[model samples]
Each structure stands twice: as structure tokens, then as C-alpha cells.
Target chain A: SQQGEEDPQALSIQEGENATMNCSYKTSINNLQWYRQNSGRGLVHLILIRSNEREKHSGRLRVTLDTSKKSSSLLITASRAADTASYFCATAPSGGYNKLIFGAGTRLAVHP
Target chain B: DAGVTQSPTHLIKTRGQQVTLRCSPKSGHDTVSWYQQALGQGPQFIFQYYEEEERQRGNFPDRFSGHQFPNYSSELNVNALLLGDSALYLCASSGGTSGRAYNEQFFGPGTRLTVL
Candidate 1:
């Protein structure tokens, strides 16, 4: 399976704190993506990092990918209460049709 | 520029029954994919359709089938439903051309299925 396995299935932190989640996958990938889901609803895409890239960032999110280790991490700096949601890591295979295999996800709780 | 859309939002069914869920791809997107997400788990790919044909499928059983129309609208049909089938069904859309690499997927709100 090409599924990404997320670490720290759950995490709790105070507002303004940095929250980080890690994911490891079994096979090579073309890219790794992070998504946020609130209330088990539709997932909002956060970012995508290609295998050739080691790190990337969006407004408040920073992602690092280590293809040699087949692992990735997502860092949300100064998270707010509104940031509370389940975070998932999905991988697109290196040599296959674009079907993503997702991890169980990390449940994040940001307390005010 | 509408994103992916799915319906009905929710459904209830019993064992041995069949149900069909529908989806409309994002504007300009011609490929559609379906996923099943069990409680507390991430979404699992069921299948994908492009150009009104099944392009790829996951490990899902034949009981789960789908169709994609020329307009890029899609449907997921499940037969002989079981209790384990209860979950959130998600639809995603990407790619405007059949030869393009659709790496970025836009997801719909999803349809929640409850099996009795």
C-alpha cells in the first residue's frame, strides 16, 4: 500500500502555539499533500510538495518533505482556535494514475 | 467556476438494498473520483472516471460501481449494502483534458450514508 501513516494521531495546544504533524509513507511518491477537515466535512487543501522539493510554505503553514526517508511534516505557526481540525497527509504515487492514498489523520485541538 | 458538487447529502439504507449517489465535477474538470471514508479514518479511493470510462479503480469490490456522463457528472452505485458500508462518500474532480496530469483534486462536501 502507498498509504501515508500520520504520527501523533491527536494533539492539543493553546492558541498562538506552533503545531506540527508528521507522516511516513511506504512507497515512492510524486508529491505529498496536506489537507484540513473540520467537523468531518469536506477537506480543504493546504499545500502540496513535489518529491524534488524539500520544503515549502503557505501563509501560516510550512511543509517539509524528505523523500530519502519517505517522510513529511506540516508545521502551522501560531495556530488559532479556528485552526482546530483533523489534518491528513495524502500521497500521489510516483508512477501511477493520480489516486491518492491517505493516512488516518492527526486530530488537532487548538484551545483559546 | 463551481467546485465539485454531490447529492443527496445523506442517505439511509438496509442490508441487501442498493443506493446511488451523484456528483458533478468542478467546472472545466473532466475527471471524477470517488472515495469512502469510515468514521475516524481517512478517505479511501474507490474509483476514478475520465471521458465517461472507468480509468482506475482501487481495491473496492464489484458491488461498488460508477458511471460518468459526458458532462463530467458521475454516479456511485452500491449493491447489497452492509452495515460496514456506512460512511461518508466523497467525490473529487480534476483535469480538463484526458491527457493531462490531474494532481490537484477539488473535493465535494460528500454524502453521508447510514446503513442499517
Candidate 2:
């Protein structure tokens, strides 16, 4: 199983505060991706970090990948009430047909 | 320009019954994948289709099968459905096998399946 496990299954924070989520997976991977899912809706792609990349940033989101430790982290600076949603980390294992294995996800609640 | 699309939006079925869910991949995408997301859990890979054939599959039972048309549209069929089969069926699309090293998948709204 190439599934990733996210730490802190849930998180609650106030508006304007920062939120960080971690994920760990087994087996080597080609890349890791982050996604956000709203209540009763499908997931939206957030970012992708390749195995060789250490860190990348987009807008208010910063993603760090530590291939040596088989882990990754997502940092969202200045979160808003609309940022409240479930965050998932998915891994595309190496040598596979590009199928992604997702983690259980972290449910984030941002209080306005 | 269109993202992946799935239908019908919602479905209800009983045990031992059969159901089929449909999906249309994003424009210019030649690969389609299906996932089953149970409550409180992440989406589990069901299978992936490319060139109108099953290129890869997850550890699902034979009761769960699929077919991809030449148009890049796909269908997931589950026979003898069980209560545990209830979940959100998501359809994702990407380029083809020769795509970039990191082929980003675009997901659809998903079809909610409820088994009684």
C-alpha cells in the first residue's frame, strides 16, 4: 500500500492564523500533491512537489518535501474562514501507471 | 476547457443490485481514473483507463468493473452491491501515458452512491 498518512486528523484555528499539515507515506514516489475538498464536494488540486524538489510556494501555500524522511508538509499562511476544508496529501508512487494513493486527510476549521 | 464531468449526481440502490456511473474526462485528456471515497477516509483507487482499455487497477473485487469508450468517456459498474459499497465515486482525468513526469489529474464533481 502506497497510501500516505496525515498527522493531526483535524485542526481548528482562528482567521488570519497560519495552518500546517504533515503527511508521511511508504515506498518511493515520483511526486506528492495537495488537494482541498469542501463539504459535500469534489477535491480541488492545490499543488504538487516532485521527489527531487525540497520546497515550493504558490500564493499563500508553501509545500516542503523531505524525501529522505518520506514526509511532506503544507503551510497555509493567513488562513481565512473560507479556508475551512479537508486537506489531503496524495502520492504517485514510482514505476506505477500514475495512479495516486491519497491519505485520510486533515479536516481544518477556521473560525472567523 | 471543460473539466471532468460525472453523472448522475446521486444514486440509490439496494444489496445485490447493480449500478453504473458515468464520467467524461477533461478536454484533451486521454486517461481516466476512478476512485471511491468512503466517509472520513481518503479516495481509494479503483481503476484507470487509457486508449479504451484498462491499463491499471487497484485491489478491488471482480464485482467492480469498468469500460472506457473511444471518446475518453468511462463507466464504472458494480454488481451485487453491498452496504459497504456506499461512497462518493470520483472521476479524474489526465493526459496520456506519454505525458509529463508529473501528470496532474483533474477531478470531477463525483457521483454520490448510496446503497441500502
lDDT value, residue A80 of candidate 1: 100
Task: Report the interface RMSD that candidate 1 achieves against the true structure, in angstroms.
Answer: 1.5
Interface RMSD of each: 1.5, 1.7
True contacts kept of 1: 0.56
- Top-lDDT structure, candidate number: 2
TM-score of chain B of 1: 0.96
Per-residue lDDT over A31-110 for candidate 2, one digit per residue giving the tens place of the 0 to 100 score: 99999999958989999899999999999999999999999999999999999999999999999878999999999999
lDDT string, candidate 1, B1-116, tens digits = 67889999999999999999999998988889899999999999999998889989999999999999988899999999999999999998878765348368889999999999
User: Ten consecutive residues with minimal summed lDDT in candidate 1 chain B?
Assistant: B94-103
